[model samples]
Target: MINQTGKFIVIEGLEGAGKSSAIALVNDLIEQHTGQAPVCTREPGGTPLAEKIRDLVKIADASDPLSDEAECLLIYAARTQLISNVIKPALAKGQWVLGDRHNLSSLAYQGGGRGLMPLVKAVSDACLAGFTPDLTLYLDIDPKLGLTRAKSRGQLDRIEQQAIDFFERARQTYLQLAQQDDSIIVIDASQSLELVHQAIRSQLLHRLPLLFANK
Candidate 1:
């Protein structure tokens, strides 16, 4: 049976961290064990308005550059829209919520990478209040390797196009935050896909036993 309180699980990582595959694994596991599919959502998206904001945040224009503060606000704006319209509503109905790159993405990219922690923190405080994920799986990988993988996919977006040093800083921040938060589990994303998937499954099963009570 579904639990009385819905759980929010977020997958966080830098570019090319295999978040899509991780999300798929989590969703499949939840359905297999709980017999209920989670409501999947992605940051800077999952809503019409949020999607438009995503476009604005991604499309690069060298001549008309976006300031760090502006970028930070845009991200939070998109997040607020998604949370208010989709995430919260789905959870209220006792449905699990699976997120691909939530608040942590902003903390890593905009705050750590772009050096806008104060602005990001202010926006997060004002917008999200104390909202947090029940379980966060952070995929850790070397910035260079991750960037190479991302490049193989296609042209990098504005954020993805950042320098390797930027991503390294982001990775460090992710690691630090993971250590501080017991709910955040760090996974070695450099491993083989199967191994990574297995690790994710193991962590989920360990952290959220209630979801797999029937299994």
Candidate 2:
């Protein structure tokens, strides 16, 4: 049931909000509806150049640390490559793009965490030209609990190594933006895995019913 047009859906959350599982859940539903797999992407690294930037973002040098402004620029650079070379083309060709994360991450992480909303928004507007997802599922979780969960996986990345206050600030930004935008929906990720999945499913059914109508 591949439609003539494609939709872009993004999943947003801090570390350890179970984004990977949530992505799998949504991807399965979309595949079932379209009878094909959507093009899956992750921010900061969907393309070859983007992938390199993603590594750089995660493992910064302690010698001359990346400035907040510099980090924002690098992210947008990666995003530009992803959008110009990957995401936009996929959408234009009537292929659904399922993104692991998107601009929202920047707003939350860089804008809120680093107190650079003005700079991040400016860069976003210049780079995206108002392009955005059809639907965004935000998995909300407590930063402390989320980081604890993240810790079990392995060593934290440079971004993940931020202080508790930084993540709290980011979470607040995520909530504020979600409240302002109808396209963004917040799901309580603090719930059990099954419950989280259930909420995500219900949201898809409510927000994008057509995708599930035939299937």
Candidate 3:
């Protein structure tokens, strides 16, 4: 049964689309209203074991012998752990949980971006067993601009260093997913950080007026 007092909000987007920053802003907003800090986390890591998998994926060198299928499966394994250990328990306790990335990241990044849709869906369906987020905030940004910001940063991780074309494909896939799901809100992230935060706030309020109104 769904909990009456909590909400699950997932923030998704390309690498440089400002997902981390937006999550901070939204958490603050939610706490202001709800009087409790939301549970914030990210995947491929939410538990101790899941975090190990995250490190393997992010820091693995090209010379490592991990196959595409293996990589995808590991991600799902971590996701399964995350849901069992963190998300479900938080909701059971009536605490909102805001995730930096969720299952959609796999659908867009590995499936759409890397052409592994079948693999992504199979793992998601088998392990997830039909769990879904209440709302997904897709921070949309052009690949060129997003990559520019990413490159300006220090050493790039495995997914971060993927070809620019990969991100383009990922962004397009995100849009397609958003179109199909009314719960997904795509916010143009090319604007200033403040503006983007405002947009997120407005969108969240519009979607869950009762929750925001009572807070």
Report the error of model 3 at residue 207, Å: 2.3
Per-residue CA lDDT of candidate 2, range 1-35, in tens? 64647788999999999999999999998887767
Candidate 3 collision pairs? none
Using lDDT as the measure, the top candidate is 2
Full candidate order by lDDT, most accurate first: 2, 1, 3
Sequence-dependent TM-score of model 3: 0.93
- Looking at model 1, the pairs that clash are none
TM-score of each: 0.95, 0.96, 0.93
lDDT (Cα) of model 1: 0.88
Q: How close is candidate 2 to the true structure, as a TM-score?
A: 0.96
Predictions: Cα RMSD each: 2.1, 2.1, 2.9
lDDT of 2 at 13: 99
Candidate 1 residue-wise lDDT, 158-179, digit = tens: 8898888999989999999899
Query: How many pairs in model 2 have backbone atoms within 3 A of each other, for residues 3 or more apart or on separate chains, i.e. clashes?
Result: 0
Clashing pairs in 2: none
lDDT against the true structure, per candidate, is: 0.88, 0.91, 0.87
lDDT of 3 by residue, 5-35 (tens): 7788899988778987899888887777677
